[model samples]
Target: MILRQHGPQLLHHIKILKLKKNLDEHLNNLLTSPWVPENTFQFPARGKRNLRFQSQRQTLESLSDSLDIETSSKALSFLKSTLTSEFVVSLCLLANILQSTISVYKILQSPYCDLKSAVEHTEDSVDHFGNIQRTMDVKFSKIFITAKALMSQVCEEIHFPRVAPHQHYRSNYSTKDPESYLRISVAIPIQDDLINQLKCRFSDRKDLLGTLQCFIPASTTETVDAEPLK
Candidate 1:
């Protein structure tokens, strides 16, 4: 039912998405230009494996210094360490996804009316997010969404303040600048049920709700209060 009602609006959002993709490409091109080339290298996968194994072996050697190390025994030790490193890395990657999902769930459950309020209410969200931007060597300027014309929750702008020097990434040229970022629009088909869910979640947290509600308006039961209803 929600999709049916917002399908046309979703199509309109696609146009904005295309524009976002183009903007991202342009920014990437500029950021990766000769003068501000992103520091990246293609390490041979095999070499990476070797280094992983070596690091593990060194760790084990330090912990178990009293262990007897014979010539053939050392070769076996190296193989075991390499396999362990591969397993550890794989597990870490999986764990990262799980952790990210949990964080998303928490943000959704919070009493913020929309994503913007949620960010502000939980300043930790921004701090951790800033850390991630640096570690991931990437940044997100904004997110855009479009709903029905009658919906009054559309955002005029989303702000990301300047990242502190310690928190800023090496490749980000605007580290000292007041945080330059791209803008994104979200044009998902919206529904009353979804709006109600958001409102209910934020019912107890009025202060935070104000900010969020500004971005995602409540779904009105009657057309009289609707923004663009005709």
Candidate 2:
């Protein structure tokens, strides 16, 4: 004979399991539908890939709707927090940067790629990111516009965060507009960091490639000298 357990804890656990099952079913249905444009119902993939965040940003609106608010209020609230203008703008900017970075990364990862090609591609990507940093205002404005367009589709408007007066240990830049604040606080720093990281990662490789170039026939001149080789 076995003892039967009956308690409020068991009842609550059953309800929680049922809720999770329902949420899973809803997500499966959304992902399985092929009729949706761009299949926007797909959730962000889990990985060490930047594409995950890009997908998350793309499906944010649809994903938010898929959650049953009454049952998943905490999840809904957390998702909604990312829907803010600044967050969206940052997402757009990061997606833009990562798309270019991934393209270069793919080429570098190709089996056929040579040292020269790798250095060239790396430098090109660094240059591209450098340009964004140089013309940050213009580039960030475009990203901001794109963010606004995306938010508009979700019936949301761009709004700046409130600045508290005389906050403790706060480094205020005193920005009066959303664009200025976001550009300074988000876009510029991200772009700068990307550029710095790329340079740091590729600097030694570039030096090595340059030193080895003299051995390559294509890089050699008809009148190659010992000094040039050295």
Best by TM-score: 2
Maximum-lDDT candidate: 2
* Model 2 quality (TM-score): 0.62
Error of 2 at 116 (Å): 2.2
What lDDT does candidate 2 reach at residue 150?
A: 70
TM-score, model 1 to reference: 0.19
Instruction: Tell me the RMSD of model 1 versus the true structure.
Output: 28.2
Stretches of candidate 2 above 4 Å error? 1-77, 165-171, 210-230
lDDT of 1: 0.39
How large an RMSD does model 2 have?
Answer: 9.0
What is the per-residue lDDT of model 1 for residues 1-230, given as tens digits with 9 covering 90 to 100?
99999998897687557645554544443343222245323223433333433444444433333233563366467545433322333333333334444555556665665755564544544345446445432222111111111012221122334444664342223433222221111111112233344455655665665665666645542346548758
lDDT of 2 by residue, 1-230 (tens): 12245576676677667655655554543454323485222322322223333334444434444435663455567667777766788778876766667667667778899877888898888888887788888888888887777776656778766677766653345788888888887788777888888889889998887787657787453565656555
